[model samples]
Target: MAIFTENIGKVSVGKAVTWDRDAALLYALSIGAGRPDATEGIDYTTESSFGIQQKVFPTFAVVLGGSGGSMDHLGDFKLHQILHGGQSLVLHCELPPQGSVTPRSYMSAVYDQGKNAIIELTTELADPEGQLVATSVTSMVIRGETGYGPRPERAGSWAEPGSEPDAVIEQATSVDQALLYRLNGDRNPLHSDPVMASKAGFPRPVLHGLCTYGMAALALVRNSTLLAERGLGSINARFAAPVFPGQVLETRIWNTAAGALFQVLADGKIVLDRGVATAAAAVAQDAAELQDAAAN
Candidate 1:
């Protein structure tokens, strides 16, 4: 069956979600934080470290506030035919080590792209008190779903900065990176099963796009003291290609007046592009504040 465009604007019921210190720490390590050198990012990795207080990475909100939109309503389609096209996230405040929130997802839009259809979902997560914690917008491309109309065009383009990047941080994904990242809630076999990957036209299982996204976010925080102190107000990126596990990911960042423009490259090929990281208000410069985001 084809994507049900009629499902657009559908709203999902609120679903409660919670996470604790262990979940946060696991997310950090899955993205290769504090690896090889345990001392580098003790704040995110070790909860009971002498005097350091563990803090959650701002990107952790993505896992918590996933598109609660139900795919079953979108009509029948094979999972392997879908691709993670893009993602955008906005955080309202610093995530505590442990917290609970109810998330509701909306089927916002469905666009025809000639041979494929793009389905966008928007999710809002709020605390028990009804204060918004995070908002996430995710887009998925369904392959071979054709004949709706011409593709819609985004307004702007991502131009490579003329000057050199302000910062470049490289992180290596282990051979088991996908295996570990799957534990974070995404269990799509495309990242685990070779047979399923073949059905998706991949030589082998590829890394989760969101995993690479989270890695890029953490890299930015570790490379910039300003970002670490201020925290990230928002992050947006478009997936340009698939990144296989065991490959090295290099995040190139150009600091902008608004925040920063970034891209993630693997083996010299840009895998994530049109990236933007919005910096939150700067907090007081203190030891405690520094430790809170030491390894974001």
Candidate 2:
């Protein structure tokens, strides 16, 4: 199948979507936040004042991508073959405990690799008063689903580190990470039912896509030196394999001028690769403004 050149510049902006406390809480739970032994504190899972102020789990931004858009319309490709390659989010400010938000999203770029395709999409979330809340970018890699034809002008592949990664972080998924994540409203039984999962070619229930997403986020937060210095501005990655619960994920980090390159590996195999996270420059600007205010 060939891509629709006419849809190259396609864009879609959606109405403001209000998120209540329930929604926020539910999203947190979806990423295994409430689990008894998860690294995140138990306050997030309980009803308390401190829980209300807890940082929103970063992976919750995935829900914001859906308003109205057809993947088929954008590319002459099979939706079934489309896999979420990677995702990244930057929080402009602390999200309010509860509030409404409007999200604007669009396809920023598409690269054809002859045998595969890379699609990049961006989404912006704003509050009712028109303040920007968060910005997210997602990259999808369609394997064996690329459009047939001549190759475009060549651009070099992003550089990967030649030396051993500077750091490695590992985490194991709970047996119920998928079941727990489904409470957030994604009812895909592939993560819940053993029979369904087997039918889908898994020996057991699989983890939720967002759970894998959260694991990736944890990798970024725990291992990146740049994020600690300036905060995460964005992340881009490609998902390469399905992760079953109870698998130990080892995330490796590589430093670069443009961003930090990372990968998520399971069972000694690379499951999520070509991962990148960029830090926010505005954090320094905001700090400077605060310093000036304090001096005044």
Candidate 3:
């Protein structure tokens, strides 16, 4: 069976998740908040600053408010043929340091691209007060499952950014990075189960794409040169390759008329490509912010 385009608008509720500060801190560290003895972002990765202030990384919304629904309603396709294509996040406001959020999601679009089917899922995350926290849009490519779903009625709704990056941020991924990242919510065996990894045709477990996304966004925000201008408005990327633990990630970005274009690489390999990040639109900030961001 191919992707069930008929179910495009069907909606569902994901299991609610009660988030806390400890978990938030763990998430911060997993994304390279406080690593290599860097004190710049200790506020995110450590609790020492909790006495003064409680902060949450904006990107945490992806996991904290992640849609926990099953996509079985779509169609039957081999799991091995599924690939994470891209992810984008839109934040309405900063999330609280700790709170419970339930994600309501729907299948937005299904595209038949000759050799594979593309599934687009959108999830809205709301706090207990029903206030929107963030929205996550994820696309998955289903191989060998094609010619059944209808082409998108809208054209050019989803397009890749331009070539070349204007800014590049490099960070090292720890060998145990995946171990800590999985604790954020996704306990998927594919990221930790050696047997499952091998069966999936990998020598070992692979890092989660979301983790790479967090790193990419944070990299841009952490860049002194970039932070000197504005904050991150939205982040988007396509998972181009698998990133093994202990790899150095280089997030290359280009300032665009629309926002920012980007791509990620590991050991000279393109891992996440066709990236885009919209700026917060000229947020006032002095050069001092750059000094602070560079501490990390």
Candidate 4:
């Protein structure tokens, strides 16, 4: 509570980062995209599968700002009790297949619930050319750290999910899900160590929250009428429960004027709730993006 109040607007500038096609392909595979020996969609999991056809997955944007790891000064707080609350991503432009980027991250807001505290963070991702690519908003909730400060009003992510859904997509996670995802450079011991899991009050190491989010996002885009090349306009969702590796996730979706509404159920529990996704054609976005002219 004291730490978050002290750093409300402080910005953290990350060192330069560079990634290539192989990085993109591995990221795709980590999220359960097509496989190397896939009869179709081979370009996603295999960098050398196709020359010009290979493309980067839009969800890969989540990893651009250091695999969504801790920001510069966020280490000041006790992170062992921290849980990823939710994430919302707004894409300003298509992410490059191979490029260098530096991030500007800041503490946005803090919401003090009765039993937990929600710390909000926003990071701007920019290419070496200074072109803004994406904006990621993440919320981390620290459990058992409540009552230290006055309760702050909840914002953006507190909405509840609908009881009924228009559609549902079920996806199964591999037993080695966390192992594969860690290769993307987010080797957080909390997601990989059983000892760490026991210390954290879980039965075993849990799957990355973003891993579940990525699978849900993939289902949202693939099932929509929008073209895959166009991708999504905005994506948001809440993380409610821990998902173990090899669990089956059922993502329920509802089409709406804004785009879509969704919630994910795992092991008979809602793991991701209050979700929203929007889509727009790439040509329209590309033209509007060219008009902005803002650089990092």
TM-score of each: 0.86, 0.76, 0.85, 0.84
Q: What would the per-residue lDDT of candidate 4 be over residues 1-296, giving only the tens digit for each residue? A: 33446677788888877889889988888877762235555666665654646677777888877523454355455656677888988777776678888888888777776788777788889888888888898888877665446645533333445567667888888999999998987888878999998988889999999999988887787665552445687788889898999999888887765467788899889999888777755434544766786641
Could you list the CA RMSD of all candidates, in the order they appear?
6.6, 5.6, 7.4, 4.2
Clashes of each: 0, 6, 2, 0
* Clash list (residue pairs), candidate 2: 16-102, 17-101, 85-237, 85-238, 85-239, 86-237
The residue-level lDDT of candidate 2 at 18 comes to 67
Best by lDDT: 1
**Candidate rank order under lDDT:** 1, 3, 4, 2
Whole-model Cα lDDT per candidate?
A: 0.83, 0.67, 0.78, 0.76
Superposed by TM-score, candidate 2 places the C-alpha of residue 183 at a distance from the truth, in angstroms, of 2.6
User: In angstroms, how far off is 186's CA in candidate 1?
Assistant: 1.4
lDDT of 1 by residue, 82-133 (tens): 8789998878778889999998888777878767988888888899998888
**Local accuracy of candidate 3 as per-residue lDDT tens digits, 1-296:** 66777888788887777888898898889998886666776767766664556678878888864644677887787777888888888776777777888888998888777788888889988888888777888888898776655765731123554565566788899888899999998898999989999988899999999999998888877663544366665677788899989889988876664456678899999998877666554311322465689986
Worst lDDT 10-window in candidate 4: 151-160
Ranking by TM-score: 1, 3, 4, 2
